[model samples]
Target chain A: MENQKERTTIVLFSGELDKAIAAFIIANGAAAYDHEVTIFFTFWGLNTLRKDEAVNVKKGFLEKAFGWMMPRGPGKLGLSKMNFAGMGPQMIKHVMKKHNALSLPQLIELAQEQGVKLVACTMTMDLLGLQEEELIDDIEYAGVAAYLGDASQAKVNLFI
Target chain B: MENQKERTTIVLFSGELDKAIAAFIIANGAAAYDHEVTIFFTFWGLNTLRKDEAVNVKKGFLEKAFGWMMPRGPGKLGLSKMNFAGMGPQMIKHVMKKHNALSLPQLIELAQEQGVKLVACTMTMDLLGLQEEELIDDIEYAGVAAYLGDASQAKVNLFI
Candidate 1:
């Protein structure tokens, strides 16, 4: 029989642009190394998977407040440090473009094309009052148990 | 031969109080499960290992600025969210005390008592101009290669 592919998992727990980019870059690199990679987005990390445009979804007051308050999608995320009222992300994007490095959105697409599994944490979605329609297409929804199962089996598991 | 202990590693990359607490909680839990746990402190996360009082180590102007600017230790870190000019940490500390949860310092002591390996990233120390004298005792200093080696061998590797 053929050998099984090595597995890697990342729990994306931060919502900032720089952290998300770091998480995706690592995930893509692991996928390139032929690992069966899974990026499980939870808590504020779920913001990375949101669609850019506003989604028409009915929600309670708190949920609506969350929707309005949180950044809509990857393009809207701020840098974790040196944000300087959102200018840090712009500088980072410019530097990435100049260096010929893939932007975070492009890196994410590359991950998807590389068959890296993207799983959104359902429990966090519930907590953040986010709906499936509000997220990008072609991702799976799961909870902590699923993540724990994957992480327990994978040698490279990161909570980013 | 006896079974090998399950290995786990965590890269503490955030310096905030809440993140440090979370990292220690997970590390402590994994250790309790009989895993050989290692927490490699890097970047801002190295602040978690610092001594509260100022150190007499000589440094350049830039390094001195970094040392002066960054939080002194676990007790000085701010919350990641809702910092409210440092009030957030105080509130959290009060609540943790009320709940009888171990404070961050207590958690670090417990980690030490449990023989959990605490490694400070030497590369980060150099970058931030932190001398060995500035950090707490009973911990190690290593670079990224050492961390990658541990991560590759461990089943659970988290970057927090």
Candidate 2:
């Protein structure tokens, strides 16, 4: 069981706010069990780990133009087929709040505390006009090939 | 631009109430613009589409046993980081509500009215002991192969 725990890691691919949150959720859960966690933030997922910038930034027209159409904030993400008009986001936020789940800011803290490896996609940074200085401190830069190399060894690899 | 609209399709992946609301917000927006729409549900996502299930169900040990380690409702989901101690789910809910996003219930109605394709995961059904009868009548069942087969051709595919 100890070996299994150590061996288990979740490789996350995220460029969106909600997906980033989802990766953190799983990372926090795994860390709660004392598992080694590594999150490879590629493409848009790098936004959260960006340094000196707000974690959640509004998507630009270029992003929208490329068919990346999701909203900027967690509250703006669409649910799977069960939205109550525009009310699904509120209900999720409300229910999560009632249940004492961690907010976005706290998740970041927990991830850091839990020793989650936050990796940023270097290629994405180059394409998006981001620099290493722009990402949050402690972020590692690697190519997708490197991410896949790490992910291939992980027991749990999630493309969030 | 017109071609882009036809290529755009919203896929709802969260079965949770709040996430579902988020999904609807995008769906409604897409529909209002007359964009092609398709929603795919998997895992817990299938719950929202359950035909006769109540919006509120008691969470048992099974939920903990299952993958749901967090609050089972929208309010408990912790929008940013799953940090609920210093923060409150109600506060999150309030912020989302103030934003005029869809409630869990409202999104479902909008999906139906807007003619979104509701696809549920068969694999999740087997794992959760859910049957087609347990789901809302509007859902269609598809295995991963089937869902991917359809999604492969989609210009836009969202995980929600």
What fraction of correct interface contacts does each candidate retain? 0.51, 0.03
**Model 1, range B1-160, lDDT digits (tens) per residue?**
1588988899888889999999999999998999989999876799999999999998876578678878999999998899999999999999999999999999999999998999998756765689999999999998765665677678778888
Tens digit of per-residue lDDT, candidate 1, span A9-115: 99998999878876786688677778789999999999999999999999999999999999988999997765778876776676567557688889889999999
Q: Which stretches of candidate 2 lie over 4 Å from their true place?
A: A1-5, A9-11, A51-91, B1-44, B52-160
**Candidate 1: stretches off by over 4 Å:** A11-78, A86-153, B58-62
The estimated TM-scores of all candidates read 0.63, 0.45
Looking at model 2 chain B, report the run of 10 residues with the lowest lDDT sum.
B62-71
lDDT of 2 by residue, B1-160 (tens): 3455453344454545556666767767767777667676655555556644233444444332332432333333434344365265466566767998656656667777887777776645544445565456666787554544444344445666
Which residue window of length 10 is worst by lDDT in model 1 chain B? B143-152
Q: How big is the positional error of residue B35 in model 2, measured in Å on the Cα after superposition? A: 40
Give TM-scores of chain A for all candidates: 0.97, 0.68
